[model samples]
Target: MKKDQNDRDSAIIIPFPGLKDRYYEKGISSLESHHFQEAVDFLKQAYQMDSTDPHISAAYLAALYENGNYDDSKRMAEELLKSGIGSFYDVLDIYLMILIQLNDYKQVVATLKPLFEENEIPPEKAEHFLQLLKLSEKAVRNQVMENSPKDDIPFLHQEQSPQDQLIGLGMLKDKNIHPYLDSLIEMLSVEKVHPFIKTAILSLFKENKIDQSILVEKLGKKETLNPMDIPSAEEFPFFHLVKNQMESQLRDHNPVLLEQILDMIERHSLCLYPFEWEPTNPSVWTAAYRAMGYELYGENWNLEKLAEFHSVQEAELGTIFTFIVKLEEISSAIVSPQ
Candidate 1:
């Protein structure tokens, strides 16, 4: 019975036996589908079966790279270069990309220098290589400056006042200002931050096109709060209604409505405090906008008085007030209890 069982097993022929091509085909298909990890799995199997095949090696290396297995990809690329197999420049490009990601700019510079001097880089690729070389050189210089002695830093000796710091930050060239973005945002979010600093930070964010929705929302909430830190909704029903509508629009990601709200605040600010708009003192923009709702709607001023205060025609003020009424109706309809 044991002999018969062995004979039956031997008779059972495995389909597609030793066919590494099948695994390579599946691996390439997965790679093309952007399933990098799946590609790596199949390609690794194919590599194991036919280790000498250049196509298998390249596909496996690419799969490894795309899957973010940089260490393995680098090792594979180095092996391919040492073996003098497949496309030398192609493998070198992959190796260089890995090094760039690893921030090994020195190695990148050393490797490319010899290739550039030997004129081995293809003309089509020469431009790209030069760009990488320039970026690497810049990165190396920045690293050196950062690692230099702390006492050599000029700003260390100079103590800047809050106002002076705000002015200095506002005057800094946009190209060199990205590193301070998080710090600026933090300052903007703090209610206790000097108005001048907040304004400087807002200008920077506006110039850089950083999303200011979070800052805008925080400022809006703070504007709604009274001196006692309680929401002023109980004292000003119209302001409360308008504020609720604005919050709903913001939650819905209605950019048009959000921009309209910002524009209203800005226009009101300009009208209420015309002389405060100074380029040198940017904090007035925030102060002006924050005071808009309270000064107009919260004060319960008549239409004529409101128009006169804003230096606008009664018709314009009436239209804006009517628009707010419409927004209130829409918000009520959506949020009304069933």
Candidate 2:
């Protein structure tokens, strides 16, 4: 659509059918050689002659992108996508990359959301799409917060409904949260606030590298935390440490046992999160999860083997596993998905 492109077209002689193939071959070679402008020139002619050819259209889109013609790249990609001229996902990916290069992050977020909700992303491409979704969302959130009239900190107050607080906290990610730090820490101290909300606040603080040392009170226990040095609130080590040890032990063989134990640990994570539980003895819990995993599969559940595998004493592993089972019974309601 440039004046030069139009001028080039005006000077072109009428081409026979075979000429388009020659143009395509040269265009693809130019693209591979990083001669983007030449690629664009040749591919544009090929695409104009055979717009229905998916291969030409795809190559033309790439050429336009490499030529730094993001607007035309996006337009061509969308047209190809709408006409079903190429692989749907491939065209979609090209369209998204164009949006990203143009810094049209809001559009990027809007485009990806439905694909995720409908489970339409191919399994092989899911990770790439998820990463794009996260990146765009952060960019969009920062932009929205920059233009907003008020910060979302007020939503963390005790009087607000948990749903509203959660909504507000969701808005707070990737922003300069320093102004809200005191309020966030105070919310953590308040016993009446939803435990889930408190956890979210702590996570936000931790992610932004809060510089101040602070006292955190949750589930009736108090600990002084330096936000920069600590894990994200959801990433508390007790929940993950046992799983890590199990991976070290059962990874080469008995992967089934390792996976089952990790699931058991995840269930416990859901139950105990934002609760004050810390693993003073990770070996005991690791052994406990292993025992329960073996029991569930009707496999041999030898106490000695479990303790030795986990480097915990046999009698102590038995005793603590009993206690953990009892703890899980009372905490069962917390892990229900809904």
Candidate 3:
């Protein structure tokens, strides 16, 4: 999460009653205005003052989720989903978003299933769900492809930007890590992981010192192996490199800068051979990549673009519009300019 000037200068929150609603309103307005830290502080006060208020609790959960507080957000989101009242669709969207933020794609798909079946989801909505699923699948595939080249069988250490890393770690540390990651891998084998997720995993490994290869190997062996391994090995270096990139980004306190940098990348991005991004507006493509978080930005970039180049040509676009967030983090950093 990016720190703001005011946030750094602000004293610790001192809670008092009768101020919850005011804070809540302020928080919502702040969020709308992209004044995230102030929003968090205010919403937090509201939640503290009236712990039972679903409104306050929901806002708090959303704030935490956006700010990269995954575990707390996840716990709170589940609780809110379980006991709250609002648009079921809204709640489901938020829940799926939380799972996405945590890099827990399995749950994301699982969580969305009932929503689809229960409502007889419209084709448009189903298509969107499928698109998300495809993206998730592509992300995982990108991870496996990225790591496929490591000779020693690089651990499943994920490399993500700081905020994303936190969310990924939360997923990995979840009581259900084994099954959860395993399920994702299985899905990857069958449906293939998204390049974005793959980039995210690679970035996660590069940033943190955690030995995740063991866990990764365990999951890989427990799952499936490609008949061809060379391609996978080639993909491994990206994981670490991408992670390093995001960790560096975490220090920036300015996501907008990264977004600007990405804009530069899109402008100059080459469409080499069959691997090219030929979108009329490169900005949208960049947006989707940004959505996967900055850490994974360059991971499947060349290869996926190559694939996209051949398959979609003019239709292909980047992933940011579909995924990566931390807008508050970026905007906060913008305001503070660290």
State which candidate has the highest TM-score: 2
Q: Give lDDT tens digits, candidate 1, residues 62-82.
A: 899989898899889989989
TM-score of each: 0.42, 0.43, 0.38
Model 2, residue 89: displacement in angstroms? 22
Q: What order do you get sorting by lDDT, best first?
A: 2, 1, 3
**CA lDDT, every model vs. true structure:** 0.56, 0.72, 0.48
Clashes of each: 0, 0, 46
Per-residue lDDT for 222-250 in model 2, tens only?
Answer: 77777677654347776667778788878
Off by over 4 Å in 1: 1-18, 144-211, 214-338
Better of 1 and 2 by TM-score: 2
1 versus 3: better TM-score goes to: 1
**Root mean square deviation (Cα) for candidate 2:** 14.4
Best by lDDT: 2
Please give the RMSD of candidate 3 to the true structure: 15.8
- For residue 82, what is the lDDT in candidate 2? 80
Q: Tens digit of lDDT per residue, candidate 3, span 1-338?
A: 98888887686666565677889988876665445677788899888788777677777777776677778777877776677654444555567667766667767767766666687666545654554554455445544433333221212333222333233334343222332444334322332232334333433334333233222222122323332222222243433343335346533776554545443332222101112233344344434444344444444444255435334333333333332233333323212311
Q: Which parts of model 3 are misplaced by more than 4 Å?
A: 1-18, 51-54, 118-124, 137-338
**Candidate 2 clashing pairs, residues 3+ apart or interchain:** none
